[model samples]
Target: MEDKFIYTDKERKLSYQILDELKDTLDKSFLENDLPMLQVQLKDSVAKNTIHRNVFGLNPILCSLQTAAIAVKDIGLKRDSVIAILLHQSVQDGYITLEDIDNRFGKSVAKIIHGLIRIQTLYQKNPIIESENFRNLLLSFAEDMRVILIMIADRVNLMRQIRDAEDKEAQHKVAEEASYLYAPLAHKLGLYQLKRELEDLSLKYLEHDAYYLIKDKLNATKASRDAYINQFIAPVRERLTAGGLRFHIKGRTKSIHSIWQKMKKQKCGFEGIYDLFAIRIILDAPLEKEKIQCWQAYSIVTDMYQPNPKRLRDWLSVPKSNGYECLHITVLGPEKKWVEVQIRTERMDEIAEHGLAAHWRYKGIKEEGGLDDWLASIRAALEAGDNLEVMDQFKSDLYEKEIYVFTPKGDLLKFPKGATILDFAYHIHSKVGNQCVGGKINAKNVSLRTELHSGDTVEILTSATQKPKAEWLKIVKSSRAKAKIRLALKETQIKDGLYAKELLERRFKNKKIEIEESTMGHLLRKLGFKEVSEFYKQVADEKLDPNYIIEEYQKVYNHDHNLNQPKETESAENFEFENPTNEFLKKNDDVLVIDKNLKGLDFSLAKCCHPIYGDPVFGFVTVNGGIKIHRTDCPNAPEMRKRFGYRIVKARWSGKGSSQYAITLRVIGNDDIGIVSNITNVISKDEKIVMRSINIDSHDGLFSGNLVVLLDDNSKLNMLIKKLRTVKGVKQVTRI
Candidate 1:
């Protein structure tokens, strides 16, 4: 192989090593096609200026091919996968076209290569790829999972050789990609060794000192640690042998990055870490006895070593959501050091190592586990379409930890960690979740947003009045919960829109006006509504007042109808006012003084919210009435400002009034006896103030009430409220 190579000596050696690794797995047809393609790739590497090299100084095309080949062999991929790996980068670097690959390798290989090339272009602009970019890359190649396998292989190979590259910046970029993106991806795909190696190499390059320190510590203690592991496994090995179990046991140490993580999490040094080693027992058993054999292994190991009941994880009884099945236990070993022990059969170990791809490889076999359902859900989510946000959520769901919770009937259900009761209800059924107002976790009533933990018995509480709130979208973490909440909100919005449409039509009918499309369009624009449906939705939800539509319609109707009619004649004599502020006011016996020149004008205080003399007042001209005075901050001001700005006029006091005005005071205080009595005394003591009504409420050591009083001006009202605040037990007092 090396003698036929036209590239560098190192490249020839690496390519041969890759081919050798695959030789046992691949057949003769694949090998014959691979050699010619390899030669063509070498020639094409020079023909096209595919001369650009990665930081490792290897030609991009050759490096990618090697990486892809190594991954295919490790992943147990077949012929088309191997061919796709070889030509995946060929079409992307302008060395050859997709048509050429299709002609040479057939259409199956061409499609996979096409998917990979398309993904390459999506993130080519972003030099530093993160988990999000990886997700998009997955989506781009989701049509063919083989493309993703090749991509992950390409990433693994890059991380493997990144440290040797002279460019530290490129090394850091690749390290970040490995740690943040490819490592988790590998883990999801069930390539545990590849995942661990990617993570370790990333830590080695990203945090050099910490990596070396842990590495050196492990290396220095290797001999002593190996001896302890041997001593600990000796008893379990003997017991398993005596039990007639056909099994192989091996001692395994934790990865360096994993150990560093434990140190950071537990705030401890390396020496303080326990369970640094694990003994795995892989059994050779028929499918019928696999579970029994695994449990038997567990029993034998525990009998030999006193197992810590708290450290037992029985995944065999219920496999992880990712289809991971095993029984793990921590036991007291020799020298009192704790050692973890894993029990599984050969098939379980394969699934544990290879993930869903393993299931695909063994799909024709009857022994395939529960991965079919999980994969179905994953593929459904991926095929849901080109929604980037949903893809982000799907990516998050992939990495979510599985937590097993129980129902009131003791039925077990699995959910992501940090999933709320709302998520749980939705997982049961959409209707149950939609009507769920609260739930009882372990018989304690909790809100719908309460996060559930493992082993808690949950019972949902539903109400006919309960409906999904927009805020629920933020509280629920599961994609199902989020999707359901969004759907419920949208349905509610559409329902309200229909009701709003009816309400608007009824109002128009009552006003003897037709609901014309042209008029409605004009009305929506004038009211600042972008769409008619939005306006109707707001009206149905009671967020927008229907009166706004009627008022604006009337203005438009009058403007058009009066265009041809003669305009009304007016003179300075008709507006007889000596002072502008008193123009609309007529003299009255009440404390509200008015201008005598405006004697015939009909005027009154607006009752929606009373406007005192010192308050900022606005006069609105009514159809039959001369003027109505309202507070500037009145609730009706916004509608008036939008629909009838011309009807608004300024009004002020004549500075000659001595009458009293009623105002409401809201007061809160500590619920002490005689608190209300003290408040009344303060109000009554003011000679200029008159108390009209006092309402007091006290409960649970807290008192709140409203007081209505008459005062000459805002100054007097503010003074009275302030004096009431100084009373004992009073926390806050405000004029309403």
Candidate 2:
């Protein structure tokens, strides 16, 4: 009744008498298999298995141990190795210590247990280890696959117990895990039966309604099903037996989930799903003969039934990389029903059931290759920590889908799901990722972030001067690229910061001021900053204001309270413009350098264009924020000319010579409510000056087009553009 113990008739069989009985099974396997050296360790393997028995109460789990024992022993694994598999969950269940495992079972078993513990830790959290970890873990397995196989076996046993879980939540979690991780893994291992069963049982819990619907529908036609099976199998069996070929044929239907997937994808009912049932043919012939005879059987089946040519798949000729092989065909059976047929050797069938484990078993089962090497890459990522980009790479690169693409050299590159050309570049070499400005996909120039498909022949474009852009993050999909991009951005920020700080320090150095510790302290403390070096840090960080800091020191010496507040001055009768600007407006006798003027230089309206006193102005200083005068009244000047208009200054022709400034004018009027260009007449009639950029926003009855011009004096420039406001359909026009 306790959650920790599975109280069953089998649990009662754990008495000394039954222990001896189980020991007999172990000793029997020991005599049949295991090394002459390992026979001495029989009691140790059995003791570990017995100790592992009390760790889980699930009766089905205990049953799985027995089943796994049969499998491990059948593979001729050594006693110590078998013990490791039996006690695989001992660490997960908190029943035993790693030290105990090392001390009792030996260091080799302890290492496997340790690796299994790492895998369990990876599973405990939702994060699938990142690709680096996954890759490294796989590489570690290059040394030993027993660790990999043992972990695989533990997952298989857990999947086997999923259906028996009484707790609905636990059942769903187990089934969901089985479907998401285990089934794919099983398929990857070439264990067809485990994958199918995992999917089938998972679908029952994941989608109960569809499961029951399919079950009910199938049950309702039991007699008809049996009849169909008989009608379909009789001819194939009779012909095969008569042909002197020994084959076993059976019919199978996909699980409800598979059927439902078809329904969802095709948007059809169950009845519309053709070839739902599969006919399986197991050949007892040799590997090569199995394929030839299977094709011969296929010919016979096609002759008997209307074979669908498009449905035939020959995997035996080129087995999948994960080692699955078969010949599949579809044909029209009795009642005009479409049915599929799968053909393979018995050895293939065993592999289909057991996958990598079974294949390892078939390889003489005494030892296994470890999966640690494969997981080494994953451990590498784990050490990188949960940097947003790094963790994302780990999740996406390591755990998403695996896509294998090829380089120009014919080497296969495995990429994470949605990996782009940029990711591929980074995967090859960090320099490739860094210098990869763009590349070609299938020999056509494409964006760096282009997602690569499986079998894509990617050719990366690289340049030494090319650097990653901040916008690259938008399209680059691989975690590697993302992490690399982030790293690059951080480096760029550091560079920017250093540049800003250096520029600031150099300017102060030119002014004969030493930016010493105490002087910086006085400046920073007065500004309410925490640290003196932080001022330089912010400058180097490219976040501090050079002008403000420089001006702050200037203000301390000069003590001026006049802020440049703009005011328009004009009289309707006289139309004379007044300059309400600062009297300390600078003189441009010298080139515009950092000066006392607010615009950073001395600027004045020229008499040539006669920029009016009220016209807006731009001062581009020769130094940082330098001064080059422009009139806010200029039409081209409205956006930036008026943009920094407050940065404008009112100046007189106190200059000894004539000077000119650029400015703009605007003509405003109504766009005809129906459709007419009222404002166009004014611009066409009087073309005044240079035009820059025009933007139009049109709604009901409003039209505005701007015109730009060169001005000599601010006073006259302001008066001329204001007169256009009186034009008909022209609502108003200002200098800016």
Clashing residue pairs in all predictions, respectively, total 0, 67
Runs with alpha carbons beyond 4 Å of true place in candidate 1 = 1-6, 20-24, 28-34, 47-49, 125-137, 140-142, 361-736
Q: Please give, for residues 1-736, the per-residue lDDT of candidate 2 as tens digits.
A: 3233324564546433433444565675343433342323433444444333322335433553554554464222344456565565655566567787777666766765666566554343343333334433332322344555444455556656555566777777767667766566555545566567667777788888887888787788667777888899998989878877888987787776688888889999777877577889888887558778878887788889998889878877765555567888888898889888888888877766655544433432121223322233333443354111121233223223556565665455676668888888888887888899778866789977688865466898899899777788877777777898889877866776577768988787777665555455566777888854456657775576776787666544333323445557867864332233534333322222122332323444333333443443444333354344544444445565445646544432233222334555555567655222433343444434333444445567687665665544555455455545655665767555
Model 2 has an lDDT value of 0.59
CA shift of 137, model 2, Å: 6.4
The positional error of residue 115 in candidate 1, measured at the CA in angstroms, is: 1.3
* Candidate 1 lDDT, 233-329, residue by residue in tens: 7877888888999988888989999999999999999998987878889999898898988988888778877899999999888776566789999
Q: Each model's C-alpha lDDT?
A: 0.73, 0.59
Clashes of 2: 67
TM-score of each prediction: 0.52, 0.47
